[model samples]
Target: MTVIVQPTGVSAADVIAVARGDAQVEISPAAVEAMATSRAIVDGIEASGRPVYGVSTGFGALANTSIAPERRAELQHALIRSHAAGIGAPMPREVVRAMMLLRVRSLALGRSGVRPVLAQGLVDLLNHDLTPWVPEHGSLGASGDLAPLAHCAIVLLGEGWVLGKDGSRLSAAEALRTAGLQPLELAAKEGLALINGTDGMLGMLLLAIADASHLFAMADVTTALAIEAMLGSERPFLPELHSIRPHPGQAASAANIHRLLQDSAIMDSHRDDLAHAVQDAYSMRCAPQVAGAARDTLDFVSVVAGRELVSVVDNPVVLPDGRVESTGNFHGAPLGFAADYLAIAASEVGAIAERRVDRLLDVTRSRDLPPFLSPDAGVNSGLMIAQYTAAGIVAENRRLASPASVDSLPTSGMQEDHVSMGWAAAKKLRIVLDNLTSLLAVELLSAVRGLQLRAPLAPSPAGRAAVAAVTPFAGGPGPDVFLAPVLESARAVVSGPELRAAIEEAVGQLR
Candidate 1:
């Protein structure tokens, strides 16, 4: 089904569908009407020689230098060509799709003074699966993601390259022909409208928010597995205990752990057992507190994503009363803050998960289990080095979690000062997400192996389902074999839908 991009009704979920789900998009009739009104405003200014920025004059430091009427359209083309100065490997197809989707959505709001055909051009690319080759770098996140979005705008003019559906690089002209679409010529203010918005960074932020939501739920499932593996009690997940704190995420996470550990045979075996310090380590006891805080952070970031989805973020936005006004809505500071803050929460989640892996590797800490979860201990090295890998990734995540928003630099010959380093923040946050997935995979497999050694003491029904789902990845565990492939398979299980689906089958959907 196609997603309709109405001026004020776009949502973060819509971006995800168009970017990652192969959904075509269409601009709403209302948006077309709104854009026509705004385009009329730009045409009026052009005829009157009004000094409207980005309409009849130059950009950035040269905004004072007026462009001639005969050459104003060329100025738009030159802006697209010169500002498309991004360098580096292409961004992922999904991110590029998201960038294009968001760009069109913003313009559809009728504030950017762009021709409706300009907005339709982006939808055509998406409908035909023609992704412009947007480079991964070059967005300062001030005055929008200018350089990166300009690369996308260039493809619309048939001057640059686009990634064919088969992923082969093709000239934009060639791709347009294959898709049965024509290249659009630049119009006064249309090129600026195409590129001048916070679409790129916002797209990445929305993707990250969706990922964080998944991890928050999956974090609880994996945490429950570790608790049962440690022979730890589930008393900390008591409804009364969570109720005292009253954080929605904390309560939800605590409830999930309690539900997943329901009807546990291992827990029954430990019902009479005490003096396991009368409590598990903070890694287990405080799992909800730590992971729940990450969930809460995601909730906050989702709000920001929701607001950005429908905003008119272009510069010199055309007002309803026919005035063109320059605004700072293009600054990526809000998105930068959200990305950095989510990175910190995700890093902490991975850090705690890594600690659980360490505990499972040590004989003194692991109780009846052999050191490193190895049957042959000193001879095999079992998962000893896997713990090292998780620690390495967790450390990297901490370093990447540093705030990029605080590192603003001046650019545009100092005409633009205090740039939001949002592009970098969103980029590193993706690194954190991938690494955290790998790290959690390690913890999940370690806990699964520990519970297997416990044998006749079956885990909870939900825990059994989780273990069964993960066992095929590690081949049901054994004396050490080739461990790297096993971990990779486990990572696939953790990062994909299989593990969650398998567990949900038994538990009937997690919170």
Candidate 2:
């Protein structure tokens, strides 16, 4: 199915589908009409001899210089070539596709005074599975991901390299020929229109939001496993206790844990027993608080992302009244701030999960589970070092949590004095989440094995289902053997969709 781009509205889901799912994209008729109006103004501005910021004059530190009409076309090409200054590893194919899709959608809003052919050119590349070789660095993120977007812009002009569908390399010109498509020649304002936006940062932001949402849901599931396996009482998760605080996320998380632990033999087994402790540790008892805060943070991030989705983020935006005006909407502070905040929240979530894993490893702390969950204790030394691995990752997350948005370095001859560093924050957020995925899996693998050791004691129905989901990947309890592969498999299960479905099969969809 095609994702239709409108003049001022595009949904995040649609962007993801087009970028990651290879869905086709098209500009709506209204958007096409809007572009026609904006383009006419740009043409008039060129002919009237009134220089626009990007149409007939120079850029950045050179904005004071004006050029003649004959060299105006060359000016656009020069902007792309000079600004394609990114340096670092090439971005993943998905991120590159997202950058292209977002730029096209922003252009479709008709605020950038671009021709319909320019927007069509981007869609053509996407539909043909031609991904520009965008590098990972060089975006100040204050000037709308300038350097990174320039690389993508050059590909459209058929001067740069691209990665084809089959993973082979080809110059954009060669790839265009193979696909029976022609390269685009930049027009009056098309160069700046194509490159001036927060699309690169915003695209990664959208993808991060999606991944964090999934991990938040899984946090509830993993916490449930840890609780049942460690014999942690479910009293702390009672709906009555959480209703008073009334943070939406806290209430939801509490309710999810409550539902997930329903019909549990584990809780019932210790119900009347006096020997069992009255409370679980903070990580086990306050699962709702830590993970719930992350949930709430995600809500804020989504709001920010949604606003950016419909924003016209170019400098010199073409207005509804046919006026060209330079605006600060191109600054990526909003995205940078959101990305940093979410990264911090995700780091905390991983930190708490690591604490839970530590508790499940110590035999005495685990309330009678075998040491390190090794079948033979001393001889096996099972999951003992696994806890260390989780500790190491959690430690790294703490370092990565230092917000990237707060740091700034001047660029463009100090004409641009401060930058958002949003792209760096985004890059770290992706890594932190990946580490968190594995951390969650490590805790979950320990929990699954610990639960199995209490066999015939049976877990909550939801906990039982969670164990079932990971058991195939992590295997049933036994002496330590090939632990890495099992944990790796468990990591895959945690990051994938099946684990949620497996748990939901027994309980309803997690909150």
Candidate 3:
């Protein structure tokens, strides 16, 4: 589908579509007007021979230096060349696309003084599936993601490397030429406007936040499935209990759990059974509270991400009335804090899932399931070591949860004092999400095994279908085998559309 890039606003869902290659983009007419107005302001500044911060002089610590008019083009080219200092592994292609989209949106707002042709080159690159090669490091996330964005800005002048549709690296000039587009000249204030922004850090964090939000919902579904597998009570999910305090997230989580477990013969049969009495432990009973907290955190993140996506985060914003005003909106502390919060929320989910995995494996805690859910308790180890793996991940998450935003090391000889380590936060959040996914998968596998041990007493319709989806790959859990395939299959169920549809269909039957 063609993705419309309107100047009205950009959404997290739009970023997801663009990143996943489901949408192509075009600039809106409003964006063109905004760009033209900003460019006119830059032209007026040049005509008056005003000494703006970056337009007529050097940047940051070198701001006092003057530039010769004859060497302006060389100065702009040198700025891009010297600032492409990023290191480490290249960023993912999807992230590159999102960065390009966000940069276009910010420029389209017209405060950055970029020419329409420069902004349109980014749109053209996206439409033709050409992504620039951006490295994972080199940004302090203050003064904008300067080094990484400089790499991105180089493509506008057709000077950097870009990956073609077939995955080969070609010069940006060659890539643009092959696509029937010419390189753009760096106009007054254009180079500074292009590179001075927070899009690099914001793009990565936005995608991470978006994925983490979906995984937060998936965590609720998986946790409810584990709760049912243990024959846990429904007292904790009652609407009356949550309605008294009524946190939106907590209420929604309770409703979701109640819907998932409704109409189950097993739940009905155990409602008054003395064998499985009044309540389950906190991990099973207070699932909503833990998952709800993560949901609330994500809601806050969405607000912050929305603002960053449309904001003009460059220095020296050119006003439509032909004036150049320098500003510091390029700092990334807001996104830094949000990314840290997301990391903590993901850590909590992993911590709870680890406890659930522990419950399912322990003979003393598993109620009636076999030791480690093994058929022959004495001869087989069953899922004994699986719990150890889950525990190790949970332990690692504690370290990952440490906030990267709170720590800042000054760079550029203290000119950039109090830096925001938001890129570090974004990178760490990605790791935390991966770890959480594995922990959830392990708990789901263990829960399915425990449910099988309680045969004849059927699980809820959603629970049964979830079991069926994993059963073909989960095969009875004997001696330790190659579990890589098992984990991959479980992740597929958690992330795939088919499983979501099955869960929704089961919810409809329950209601």
TM-score of each: 0.98, 0.98, 0.95
lDDT per residue (tens digit) for residues 345-435 in model 1: 9999999999989998899987778889888887788899999999999889989998998997888888898899899899899999989
User: Candidate 2 at 320: error in angstroms?
Assistant: 2.4
Question: In lDDT terms, how accurate is model 1?
Answer: 0.88
lDDT rank, highest first? 1, 2, 3
Question: How do the residues 80-175 of candidate 2 rate in per-residue lDDT, one tens digit apiece?
Answer: 998898887788888888889899888888888889999998889889888888878889888889988999889888888887556656788888
Give the runs in model 2 whose Cα sits over 4 Å from its true position. 164-168
Predicted candidate 3 versus true structure: per-residue lDDT over 274-319, tens digit per residue: 8775778989888888888888888898889888877778788887
| Overall local distance difference test of candidate 3 | 0.80
RMSD per model, one decimal: 1.2, 1.3, 2.1
**Candidate 3 weakest lDDT stretch, 10 residues:** 502-511
Model 2 — TM-score against the truth? Answer: 0.98
lDDT of each: 0.88, 0.87, 0.80
Error of 3 at 407 (Å): 1.3
| True-structure RMSD for candidate 1 | 1.2
Candidate with the greatest lDDT versus the true structure: 1
**Model 1: residues with Cα > 4 Å off, grouped in runs:** 164-168
